[model samples]
Target: MSFLELSLTLHARQQERVELALEDLGALSITLRDADADTPDERAIFEPGVGELPLWNEIVLDALFDSAADRSGLVHALHELVPGLAPDRFTFREVEDRDWTRAWIDRFKPMSFGARLWIYPSTVAPGADDADKIIVHLDPGLAFGTGTHPTTALCLEWLDATDLEGRTVIDYGCGSGVLAVAALKLGALRVIGVDNDPQAIEASRVNAERNGVADRIDLHLPEDFPRRRENILVANILAGPLADLAPLFADCVEPGGLLALSGILQGQEGELLVRYAQWFDDLAVAVREDWVRISGRRRG
Candidate 1:
């Protein structure tokens, strides 16, 4: 079904208040984007952490409502609720429904993470020179971790460079199982992928099978996951959960095993370093754009 979408350009500071106002106004769904990003390559990432929203200086908030929503009344109410905003900032239109998943995947070009590893959408063709690189073919569908986002990119690069030979690994918050599968492809003896969502488990399974490493990987939900420790563990989730799961994560890695943590924003690493430092040593930081990855060896 088609829906009425109302887009508003405003200062970043007003986003939260406006988002609440939109929800109060009966918007079915809302999205925030960088208003000044006119280029196709620019993306909006909304990974929330402690007091973090990761937004540009100006934001374009889009609220979607049923086709029957009263446009004039809605605009009038927004003007009254959020005063001092220029009227020209408001734009409303009808948007046709689409298979969003297909649309997104169609645009996912082949990308290289580190020197030896590359990720290609099953729909796209890769370059001739990629014959020598370790390539991962992905049909991510509704699951996350395609190596496009910085969080997943950070993790994939770590997996690419690390020596996984004769080692077992754990991919916490496995998502599409990209990391678990990557670890296997990179010569890890075995990999255990853990995530809460059944869809994610299935996605990881499919990707692992596609890479011919299905037999070397195990997928599990958080509660069903075994208490066994491994030589390496990588988690690409938000900082809040990362901090809370530090103790569990430390236990998941054997003494002298390695740990890699992603999905953290730049300023938030200090808190994570302090939390993981309890059981981990020599925690090193890696930054890509606004994201950060923390790596260290569990204390022996």
Candidate 2:
């Protein structure tokens, strides 16, 4: 498929009107990104909660239309709908669509964490040496956690280094079951995967099954969470929820168990360290790029 991509920048306040205008112009699809994303000071928006607009102060919208559409007509219509629309605001390019999944898989390749754990996409063939290394086969999908993001990479490194042999593990906020499946491959006896998104739970289950550890992991929504105290618990959710659920998380890990919290930005670790210190001892922090992972042992 081919498309004519029209890109322009607009203030967050004007997003709704611009989006409606693009739709009215028969745009096939629209993509919004932070216009100031190249600026180092711009904060990244990971995942927005339900009904929340994924917006920044300045947003760049790229509207796609049939390649044959009249470019001049689109420009005229947009300028008419938006008073004072600058001629410089509009940019055009022809784009060819390919299988996005295959494109992602090709770029992801094989990524290794810690001593012997590696994530491989289905397209790649592992070497004979992989017999000694723990392997996880994952495909790019709607759910998160493919070992690419700094946050997930930090958590995976923590999981890979930890001793999971014959222990029960909990993967709170398990996305795509990467950590849960990795823990199982690292020798964990059983894993409990919990996520609020039904799609995430399903993705986790499918990933677990794909790795031949489905029976060892149980996926659940928060409402039906078993809440069993486990030998190890790792949560790769944002810092806010990590702090809010501290007491609940504390209750989920038995005395003397292990824990790791991730999805925290660099400066945000201070509050989490203080809050988690109450129930966890020997707290330590690991940094990867701008992301932070805090690990500690449950106080006996």
Candidate 3:
């Protein structure tokens, strides 16, 4: 069946009320986007820290409805739900249904990071030469980190270059367990994966099993995670949380252990270096596109 997509640009302040109204009016799904996306005025709406909610100042709210639904009725309802909503601002079009799963699978072909590391969907088979390569089998899921994002790629490349043989690794904020599995595949003795989101833990478990690293990686929620010194610690999370957990992260690494951090914008390196310098030495930064990765050694 086809669908009707109704969209309207609204101030960020009006999102909650308008979303509720759309749900009440039989919207099958509602999604928000930045109205200035792809423009010079585009903004970044990053993941908020615990108990914080951050959204774009101006948002494009899109609600999908059944094709037979009354468009005029939706507009009138929205007007009542949000006073002063402009009628001309409402836009909608019909969207045809297709195999979204296959489409996504088609787009996510095998991706390589560094020299020996590769990430591919389970549906795809590795090439003959890949017998010598370290492969990560991951299917897209609700959780993030498929090694496609620059932040995740940087961490994966660092793991590839590091000698993980017989080393204990900590993958803090382990989204989808990509880093944990990669470390294991690269010969780490043990790996611990921790994330605040339960879905992330589940995704990590599934990905680890897919990559046959489930036996080597232990996945847990942040509160349930055990603290310990490791030979290496990698966190592909935002710079803000990285700085906030500086002491805790420092404590997780053994003296002279390696620390690899990503999910930072280019200009944010200095602040992070200063934050981590208290416990780490030989700090260095690498850049990919607009993102930055910082690596260091735990001070002895």
Candidate 4:
């Protein structure tokens, strides 16, 4: 299916409000960008518990409009969400390639995390000799994750460095089930990946099989979250969701077990750390590019 692209520029402070409005209309994905494409000195978003999460003084919302109905739905939703805010300018055009997935493959490549891990997409791993590395086979097909992103890479590295042998692990917001699969590779006895998106869960299941560890990995939705605690838990979701899920993460990890989290802007780290401070001790962090990954043990 082809997608119609819609973009709008908004004041820095209004970006989140605009995103909420568009989300009410069901925007498949939204990304923030600078109008001038200027490289801001600060990070892009304020992430709690990471570095300083960027306040985003100015940004553009790039979203996909699947159809005319979708466009109308979004306009109506935005009007309702923000009583007076409307797009100052709007334009639409077909993305040329109906297969948006393939159009992006040229830019995607195998990424090495630190010096210990390398994530490989099935199509890109051919003739590679790093056979001993923790190789993850992800074919972005219909799913949303491949450990190439800084957030995912940070979390994967944490999992690799931690001692998971024979332990049970839970991957929260497990896009592509990459984290769970990585844990299994690191010797976790069993792992479960949970996400609200069914497509992500499906992709994760297939990827796990491709990695030859389907039997040890399970994928489900939030409604199906297991009742037991895991020895290690990891989540690479945004700061808001992470903060809201604190209690849940607290409940899911065994006492003294570690929880690694990412997908935060460098500035937001302090705020997020404060939220988790009560339940976790000695919150150590790992940094890659502009992203941050933090790990701490669940308090008993």
Candidate that scores best on lDDT: 2
lDDT of 4 by residue, 1-300 (tens): 677677776676666556544532334445566655555453253212222222455566676544433465456545544455555555555654355445344445787665456677666854656767777776544444466556777887787788888999989888667788878887899998898877678778888899899999878889988768889889987777888998888888888999999877577678889988889998987776556788899888
In model 4, the Cα lDDT at residue 208 comes to: 87
Task: Give the poorly placed runs of model 1, Cα more than 4 Å off.
Answer: 1-97, 126-128
TM-score on alpha carbons, each prediction: 0.71, 0.71, 0.70, 0.71
Error of 1 at 90 (Å): 16
How many steric clashes does model 2 contain? Answer: 0
- List per-candidate RMSD values in Å: 9.9, 12.1, 11.6, 8.4
Cα lDDT of model 3 by residue, 1-300, tens digit: 787899888887777656545643445555677877887356443323323443688777777766766788678756744567878889989988744334445556788888999888978888787798788887655455777666788899999999999999999988678889889998999999998767678878988887777888888888888998889999987667888899999999999999999877677889999999999999999887566899999999
- Weakest 10 consecutive residues, lDDT, candidate 2? 43-52
lDDT of each: 0.79, 0.80, 0.79, 0.70
Candidate 2 lDDT by residue in tens digits, 41-129: 56353323323575688877877766766789678756644556668888999999745445445656788999999999999888887
Please provide, for model 1 over 1-300, each residue's C-alpha lDDT reduced to its tens digit, 9 standing for 90 to 100. 787899888898777656645643445556677777876358474423324564688887877765766788678756644566778889999998755445445656788889889888878767786678888888545455677667678899999999999899999988778888888888899999998767678878888888899999988999999988899999987688899999899889999999999877678899999999999998999998667899999998
Question: How are the candidates ranked when ordered by lDDT, highest leading?
Answer: 2, 1, 3, 4
TM-score of 2: 0.71
Model 2, runs deviating above 4 Å: 1-98
TM-score of 1: 0.71
CA lDDT for candidate 2? 0.80
